[model samples]
Target: MSSPDATPGASSAIGSALYQLATRAVRRLPRDLSLTSAATLATLDKTGPRRVTDLAAHEGVTQPAMTVLVRALEESGLVERRGDVSDKRVTLVCLTEDGASYVRARRQAGVEAFQRLIDQLTEDEVRALAAALPALRRLDTLDGQKREGTRP
Candidate 1:
């Protein structure tokens, strides 16, 4: 079969396939947190502390929903709410040390999982993926840009 990139009109197919693959990988992993929660933590790890409202907007969730989620995380001692230095009236959700550790551990687990799977692929397939890594990383940057409203 022709690679998705080699065929025209295959963008949608590739996108759907990638989405399915990612969701399946995540689902197969054991986790205590909900997907949204994990995503929020990951975002916080990438960026810094953010207002609850900002997090809601970034996560495509309602502010109230994010509030509840943040509360849960706080209860778990994974995150804490603090007054924003520049704006005392606004509260920022900051990841705790525990939260950072959790994020690192989760990411390591994912890397190990993917590494094991990649080991099963043929050498040519592995080479192909290695060659595509740059583009894949660029896609991640584009996603971040889109989220930040810097990309069209």
Candidate 2:
């Protein structure tokens, strides 16, 4: 096994690789979809309907910014605003079927791109990546916690 001290450059190397991959993947997406909009759709698809204020908080944007995003998405028929049943004054944003399908297609495209790259790896490397997926997911969660200034 590699000693922790001996791997001083490894973290930076991995970070650089991830950044490059993400940049390339984003470039591969449809020009019509801004990254922020795509992210909002993905979040809504994963988390279900939420109040506009809640989405603003989650996305770290002002309410006005989120409202603009929602409006654009609404115009595209990707999202719909529904009056909250419990509180008629509150409007919640939910993904339409089209939105869900769009998000899924985007996700699949990203996965396919990554899979194409991963296919070049050796069998052992692929197995290692498979084994590391859970840890990588945990790391993602930890990163999110750090961003939110919360303990992991």
Candidate 3:
């Protein structure tokens, strides 16, 4: 089985190989979208509208930086700023319809790109990847658990 916590210590060969593959695959994609922007869209999509301060904290950026990002996104028609219903004083950043579509399209493109790479692999290699899919999915949960201060 693959190790769960590569955040703190050295990763095994399996982890290294997986990381390399993922990095290579991502690097092969078009650079039209920034990772930060795509990730911000995904975060908003998952958690709903949030304050610029909250978003900055989530993204590990400064509030001013996030404001700049939000402004740029707004200008691009990817996201919009809105008054918080519960608190008029607080503004929230939300994904525009176009933003959601961009996130989905980018994600699909990534999957298709990776699938093309997979298609070139030998049958047994593909089977190995298939077998590892469950474990790979578990890493998402494990990372969440870690973020929540729980061991997985």
Candidate 4:
């Protein structure tokens, strides 16, 4: 069920606000890897191994670009390409233990940063944010569905 005010304009406004907040927050974080690299690592951490072409499509980059990124990651010992068990000819990119650690640390940093900001909010504002948590989680679920091509 949709909210009464869930019109196109409202959706656009929400998207813009969320995008601005996310980009600004991420920009403030200290990181060794580029945003795209971090994102690719996070994806691998979440979904396990995937094909290079799939990663490229998911990341909106060219196959060659993904190949280069994967190469760099491999050199850093962050990811490894292994043959797919079902099909030995296909190689799947899998995240390394170090890569998972990096992802966890980065996520923890982000959580801590948000926690500090959240602590400064008033009781009412905090309550409002808490109330919105379910909706925010649902948005994340929707994004996953879209990515898996399961959305109607």
Cα TM-score per model: 0.90, 0.86, 0.82, 0.90
Question: Where does candidate 1 stray beyond 4 Å?
Answer: 1-6
Q: Write the per-residue lDDT of candidate 4 for residues 1-152, one digit (tens) a residue.
A: 56886785777797898999898789987778888899999999999999999999888889999999999999999999999999989999999999899899999989988899999999999999999899899999998888777873
Give lDDT tens digits, candidate 2, residues 38-137: 9889889977899988888888899999999999999999999999899999899999999999999989988998899899999999999999899779
lDDT tens digits, residue span 122-147, model 1: 99999999998997897788889998
Better of 1 and 3 by lDDT: 1
Give the better candidate number (2 or 4) by TM-score: 4
Question: What is the model-wide C-alpha lDDT for candidate 2?
Answer: 0.88
Worst 10 residues of 1 by lDDT: 1-10
Displacement of residue 29 (Cα, Å) in model 4 is 2.4
What TM-score does model 2 achieve against the real structure? 0.86
Candidate 3 local distance difference test against the native: 0.83
lDDT of each: 0.91, 0.88, 0.83, 0.91
Off by over 4 Å in 3: 1-11, 145-152
